[model samples]
Target: MKPGLLALVCVAFLATLPPVDAFAAPAPSLPEAGYAPLKMTIGGETRCLTADGDETKSWQYVALKACEDGSRLQNWKLKSIGNARYFIFNEYFGEKRYLRTYSKASSIALDSDTSGYSTMRSWEVSNGALNDIRLWNVYSRDIGQWKTLDADPQSQSVGISIPGGTRVDVWQYGIDMPTPQFPVAGTRKILVMATHFSDETSADSAPVRDTVLGVFGTPYYEDRSARNYLMQASGERLTPNMDFLDEVDIGERPDACNASQILSAARDAARHREKNPQDYDYLFVSIRQWRQCPWVGLASVPGNWVLAQGSSAHKFWTWTHEFGHALGFHHARILYGCPPRDGVAQLGGDCTTYNYGKAPTDPMGGGGASMFPVAYQHFAGWLSDADVPWIKHDGTYKLDPLWRRGSAAQGYRIRRSDGSVLFVEFRRPSQPFETWWGASPYVSGVTVYVVNYAPKARSMTSTLVNTTPGSGRSMGDAPLLPNHSLDDTLSGMRLTVTLAHNDGAELKVEKLPK
Candidate 1:
């Protein structure tokens, strides 16, 4: 055939094929450029991908090393090349070198060339199991070999290999992570911005403003208000000073229940009123409930913003619970259907499932107008080392009510054999706020929780232990009454409540037989 005829035939065949981008995966949402650490757990220990040197070296091998704070070698930045593909750049030498796999070697190394070898430097990223990520080299796809970035625990080396055999290393990246903001002993200024759609302006905004003021400004509801709840919960360690911005009409209805759009409009309205939203520690946006909005209240986990709709803005539990999220508290969940005697089994049993927002002893669990639990308080840095002493040996501990003022051992901590922690606290109904406990069985008793301090296990951080497994009662009746005991067979610990009174309770912690 003639050359012109052959070229024309190829063009016709190419036109019939799909576009090159048609097979590309959807791009993930990531920042244009930020410092991130690729983390993976290997051999029951957390490790991070490191550049394997103190300085920039050509062909420096990449390996999995123990994660360290302020380790520039482990810090990486992803440069997007579109289509969910990125060039991994190391931040140790100011991002001068990027990651590349050698054709003859089974390991990945740092390379400085960007003018050529596009496929060698490009990587396709996707979401993996439970907040992890999977990275596949684009060069492997060109060679018709599907391989993912894998780490070898024996060699501590990283390479591209087929997944799902004996290798189980899944990488999770933390990009521009925020510093944990614990509600310490200080006043946090809050800016409350009330907004409504143009169609919903006929309703009175005064009630909303009054509700905000009552919840955060004055003690309108006495101890039930958010201000009072925080003050008592933190033992006056944290307080709120709120400034209310006049209600603004957003001019149009939102297309859906988009929190970002609503929050942006609220912030813009605050700026119009000469109030900078950044001046306050928290930005609280209140809006009327709409049909599209599914949540009554929403908040950024460990962030400085919260949003409330309609009656949820007025409800005490909603206000405190959402703000509690802003203060870095996960949902106070309960473990159900697990063994009552073994705390470790209760935490890790495959048959057991968790119920969120069910721990009726704390506000984070949607318990009506109650203070934060002792575990949460300790996490927030509100509890001192003396307040929650670690019980290493068998002894009788005199515990005070968590809500009371005096510092007489408000809570006790026990280290389990599996590296998890057990937090034990005594609870009694405080006036005005904890009135919901009056009708519940947990009004005054000893409560225990199993806390896992792993970073990836955020959802199961603090779980309320069900003391009475077959009682057929709600989690509200989970606490141990007077003269009752809890045996943790996995931890070899037995906790017995020897005495109970209005002032406090006495718990005898003993080591059980192996």
Candidate 2:
């Protein structure tokens, strides 16, 4: 090729090569960026950094106090001050006033005294030991001290300190979430198998398969029993694949009808089949007779066994309720301890089993007639953000019945600044379960509950906010009706149902002044 042509080609190729950093966007500086607020909990209490005493005080000592939702005093604004440092400002106060530590030993205080940004008023946030979050003091510019927001053990008040191993629980206050567990996507297939001993005739085994298929496979569960309605409302769909392995000759033994024996036989039979055993997600075993058992089913994690009997043959809610366990449902007992009712003595102590045969509105609590509570629905991944809206500010909202499919919100979650939450929903008596159980006037209405997420203990407590003072069975299922308002004076929130209907309801919520 000619020298001029070669030179031209090389020049064109060079022009085509992109310049350095062509696709890169400039990173924003921290000082110019904003941050979300943080809720800090220590010593099992939610604490807010406060400018204690008169608001007009120039240098009021910053102290810890009980966290209150929507309280400007409890809301701390974290502002970036460049180079991994942050200035914590109390929203209760206006501009420039920031939390500052006067000396290493002095109590933390709020001051507008600084003419310019001070590193002594800045802090560094980082992960600490045992999953705890730590904040470091950037005052000396040496990163020397573990500055912590501490709370008094007795009064649960907050202050600044060089913390020891004590970990501070830090999280955003209003982030709503579902219960954490293994999730089942799409529709799940459940296998129902009926077993017969060597001595038993095919005639005796007929009831087992007949009842299993009739109850689970047909509309008995889906429409008539209200099981599928409950699950589908939560975004879980289950299809019962009834496989009647009638009169499988398990060698004679008195314990053959036991739960373990039945599970083993069913597993063996499934493995021996041409189809792979793992194809089935659940195993339901049925026997001929009953020996005065609880007339319930047993679930061993992913595997579930239903001991169906003639007495409770048509009461299929028992089986459906047990399968709820396999799907990762905890008993819908009164999550928090409930006080005495009608001189019957208080039941449900710290979630311990006390009130069985109560709570007819929840299947987990011997109430086969009622649907699962919003708490269980949230935990079971049934209520998505679309269904349950988290209310960050005060507003009037419309809600549909939790079971009905609609574009409207089924529930509203009002999160207190302290990380507690209020869940409001509408409940009614319409399903077959409710009709069969004779809808309790107390349960068929609107409901409100308070959920306390205890970080230190790694547990959640759900307390029902009663509608009729003490009319509910155990944890109380009755919801407040239209034109009725219930107030949580502590959280400064009032929920009033303006209109109630078979399909939905409208709620007017007011964040009352403390």
> TM-score of each candidate?
0.63, 0.56
The model with the greatest lDDT is: 1
Candidate 1 lDDT tens digits, 244-294: 766677667778877778888888778878889878878887788786766
* Candidate 1 whole-model C-alpha lDDT, 0 to 1: 0.65
Q: What is the lDDT of residue 102 in candidate 1?
A: 55
**Alpha-carbon error at 308 in model 1, in Å?**
1.1
After superposition on all C-alphas, the RMSD of every candidate to the true structure, in Å, is 14.3, 19.0
Tens-digit per-residue lDDT, 1-514, candidate 2: 0111011001000111111212112212322322223455655655555565466678777655666666666666665543224677766675568777655534567787774336567765543211234445555323355456555656554565666644342433231232222233344445655554566653355555444455544653335543344444454533344455655554454553355566676677656654344576556655545453333355432223444444343355656665555444434434333343432212122223332334545565565646666665654445545567766556778877666768788787765534456677776655444453335433345676655542211123455544543343445444576676665543566666788766778888777544
Q: After best superposition, candidate 2 residue 152: deviation in angstroms?
A: 17
